[model samples]
Target: MDLESHRFISYFLPDQRPELCHSATIEKFPPGTVIFEENEKPDALYLVLDGKIEFSKRGGLGQYQNVAWAEENDFFGEFGVLDGQPRSARAVTCTSATIAKIPRDRLMDILERSPGKVVLQLFHHIIHYLRLTTEQYVNQMVHKHKMMAVGEMANTIIHDLKSPFTGISLANSMLKDLHQDEETQEWCNLIQAQITQMVVMTEEILEFTRGKATLNQKTFNLGESLEKFQRLNFIYWNQHNINFILRCDNIILNGDENKLMRVWQNLVGNAVEALDEQGGQIVLIAAKLGQDALIKISDSGPGIPEAIQSRLFDPFVTYGKRGGTGLGTAIALSIVEAHGGDITFESQAGKGTTFYIRLPLC
Candidate 1:
């Protein structure tokens, strides 16, 4: 059951030419054509002679979620016939395709014959494929959970090390105060800087549960950032009848401003998509709270689904969004968290949502 060589099924059943003439009919389809849909009764199995076919399943929000694909010479649709069940996935033409459709009766007849080894091989191949798919998914889940566990361990380790780091910093400060010698002061400053950098670096990696990354530590101040966002998104908000508002306290923060900008833009974009044509209001507020910069983006729209709220920042977690990769919030969390910040949200079904962000201020 080599997918690429499934056209060989004809040789075992009948001569390829006669098989097409009597046992099967050759059909052509254009790209994006739906060959079959999930749960549909199987009437015919197909052998792709040319071009490509894709298979997808309906995801949580009724979105098309890709599962597998078939291409030239790949035969499919035998599952339903063999099990006397409906199709479990949707199949569509990915490109203009030439396919040979074998009737259900023809396939069943082959299974009854003595030389049904090819069909048996095909079953073995598909079962093996399904087993591999399940294994991969299980492995992925295991790895995700493992990373989360490791992240917890990292947090504990960092916390334990913090006391010693604090002591070192305090001692260094005392030395700087006691030793007024210029050369000694310079050496103390260098030591203090390196020690502070190490603590900051440790804090930065504590939230990298998914993996690792480098964050730029450049410092800059945002002046009326909320106003700037409102200006840029005014038309978009107006077009959607979404009232936009802005408030700012212009706080300075250290990080790659460009990346932070992208994060803000993505959050706002997510809000727009969450909202309907009935429109709503989006308010962006920025200020300073003690040593941290505080930003809150509130949207008056349908709130995030509770099913995915807890794992909202996990990759591929999405609800209400069509064709969304679900990486927007996850990436936003990563960027903000790596800067020793936190992003949290409060959402209630019909009441809308508010996302709060806290980042260290320079």
Candidate 2:
């Protein structure tokens, strides 16, 4: 056994059974070799003995971004081992590397019989991981709050100035029309439309700050809600050449009708925008699952990238699209969760995306 390999084990499995340490085998990989891909089943934990490893994911636009890097003495793959879940990121060798592959079953066995050392080590790793994660989360939250605060402040200013802005826009339109200049009229009309959009967005920001603009819960037919939502938003969908389909029936639920309306509105609006004039199909389905109601909205647009899925519900993490505030889905999720419900989504590149909402039946 290499001294470096032993040192790696000592860092994690110190005071463990010697036999368990001997059970781990040193594996080597060359640069560009994929150690594992995201979502692969849990197998063995890899402790890097030497060289470097890169953790990356495919971006929403079909590009790869390196999110993390691991070097000698560092470990990767513990998350999958501990959670019994698939890998969340792709790991590839950045150079010639030697790694100790610690079998998951053996690790579990040791953890069950001699939990103290294992638990201690696991706890230490978790604490360190969580510390870093929490720091990043706190920083992101602070940044988001700052952005929201600025947005709110700007919204307030806009609200205060809206009357004058509207008056000026109307005056410009009248002047352009009276001058009989098509170019000037078009420019004025565009400016007025943009100002109008800004006004609407400012109102939404104010509403989001108050947290009082969500749906008011009531017992209503889910099918009816879908129909009404579709009818109300059909023109927007049609203008964009998008197809809307409803596959739900007479499923009823106790939820805020207006809030659910917003939910559908936001989701559908997102899907349409994601399609970006290429046009696609949007499907809404509702069904009852025992004591819960299940609603799914699927889109034939480019699916959300795996990189952003974990933080997709977080506020203001946009993909840099036009008119995207990145708060719609976040607000939608908060509303659903408040109603004793949960929301989840699935997406894949080039295929499509689907959002699932599960709520307890009233």
Candidate 3:
């Protein structure tokens, strides 16, 4: 079979396929080559004869967010071809690739002559991939929150044992004071040793399980903190089209860096997911306000849906995106409160959203 027979162009009627096939010029590009930039006018629609093409966007401060990928036998730039609009996402070669570039005019001409089958074929592939990604995302979220539940339960068990154990130790001390005979003192000592062993064993178990063990607070520069955050997330950003822009005053903060990092991540991650297909921006800002450090995370996507606004911090609340147990925001709120901070947000439908956080700088 000919090369065109293996691609999306094959969906066209047999008689009309020849013209479209003839218009395509096969070309080879090395890995990491940029095929097109987002918002650039389309020159051609490309088909992957071999290798892979990543769809991503480079945004403010040169942050790159990957949106999707097209592998062997797949076609890209369909939106530009169908509507003659600027490209929505930038395309780059992920590996050495042999690609067939079909001029836009020829592709559009064939579509004009036979639009029915080809148009449906294009949209069907689009919807199918989205459905698969979404299902996988929801499943992963469910599993994550369930594990978090186990962690929280384990922490609660540890906390409850402390008070009763302290009471038992105090009572044991009184018995020792009341006893004067050697035999009575020996029995008291045995009970004390057993209690010490119990406390040691309980601590070891908690150390073994190690779920958020305790908040390790330290002083850190807020600007430096966010820069590290952005660098660490390059791989995660490779799956969505969202840019993170940070503005900070180099304010010093005393808190659990890891936990605070989780707070920012949860908020920014939700922004990226909410902007799926639409693409948007995330702005992170930090500054000292009085004795408190003010942190603001903003997103340019559609604002939070009104239905879930009131209970957004409630244990299982979620909105506008995939369905999942909504423990993320609640956990974020809990962490901030634990550090004596406050969290709140303001959102307007279609205008986007911004979340505010305040924590003691000292």
Candidate 4:
């Protein structure tokens, strides 16, 4: 039904003066046109006469999340118009559409002249809309609470394992001195390496669960740190026949060296896992981009899977890797962001994935 023939509007139009009724104007908008934005004062009430309109709220990083859709016979922007308040969400045309816009002043004028029946119908629609919104909000809150509970439980369990891992690390260190045979010594070295990895993993989990990463800031050489990490992982990378290359100038940095090293460890480790012993190349390029240190890690692996790309940095999001807790990227992101920097990546299904890390240069 068109706006003039709309039940609520038609009920009141008979009592309104002709000019007041004429104040509702028909507006045409092309696809992707924004009708209104959140926080803007409502000027008019819009009723969708044809095509579709989407309502969204801004999410993290300037993303817009769809809250609802209005199609034929649906009226929007009424809440703000009635309350004389700012819009709670943004409205945009999803497709080429025609909408009827009733100016707020004209709407109030019509309601003042109309009988109690017209106001009752308006109230019915508003109450129904509010009920649905409340239901959605409650569901979100329940889901958030469930996630918090699971996180608290996981943090306790992970915290309890730290002492036992420390004991195992100490024992692994002592075994190196006790075993003198060449073959036995090599095996002990491997065990010690694995224990070291476990120690790093444990630390990452604890830090993530705490939600606040404390940095031990100091001036250090970025290039030297990369070289040392590559050296330490040389044997592991070579075992998979993966060619690892580091091309970086000796850039000095002022940050937490240990935390930054952990970021590198996680990124490099993920790249290696993506390669999966099929012999691919991983390159670490560290260069200066004006006042920022730009570091890019590119891998010629299969690339990140499409399913988890949106929540890639969210904790406990993992793909097909065995024994994966999925906290590596999350921890890496936390550390980098804590240092007043950002991390982003580009990936393609068949080609490869590249991660870019930008940190303020000192």
Compare the candidates by lDDT and give the number of the best one: 4
TM-score versus the correct structure, for each prediction: 0.44, 0.51, 0.43, 0.59
The digit string of per-residue lDDT tens for model 4 on 1-362 reads: 66666555654546464554478789899999999999999999887889899888898889886667788878899888889999999999999999888899888877777788878878888899888877766765564565566567667766787788688768876887787889777767666655665655555566566567878799999998888677678888999898998999879999988788889998888888877868799999999999999999998988899889998998778754666767789889999999999999999987989999999999
- Please name the candidate that would achieve the greatest TM-score relative to the true structure: 4
lDDT string, candidate 1, 215-314, tens digits: 7668676654445445555667788888887777868777876567656876887888889678888888888899988899999888998888999988
Cα deviation in Å at residue 359, candidate 2?
Answer: 1.6
C-alpha lDDT of candidate 2 relative to the true structure: 0.77
* Model with the higher lDDT, candidate 1 or 4: 4
Count backbone clashes in candidate 1: 0
Error of 3 at 221 (Å): 1.3
Model 1 stretches with alpha carbons more than 4 Å out: 1-211
1-362 in candidate 2: lDDT tens per residue? 36344544564445564756676888889999999998899899888888999887777997766667778877788888888998988999999998888899987776677647657866787688657755655675576576678567857787698788878887987888787778776566656654655555455556666664544567998887677667666767899999999988568789777666667777878889989888989998888888998989999988888888899988776542588768888778877887889999999888888999998887
TM-score for predicted model 1 compared with the true structure: 0.44
Clash count for each candidate, listed in order shown = 0, 5, 0, 0
| Poorest stretch of ten by lDDT in candidate 4 | 12-21
Candidate 3 lDDT over residue span 81-157, tens digit each = 87888998889999999888889888877788886777788678878877865665566557556656655664676
Give the whole-model CA lDDT for all candidates, comma-separated: 0.75, 0.77, 0.77, 0.82
Name model 3 segments beyond 4 Å from true.
1-213
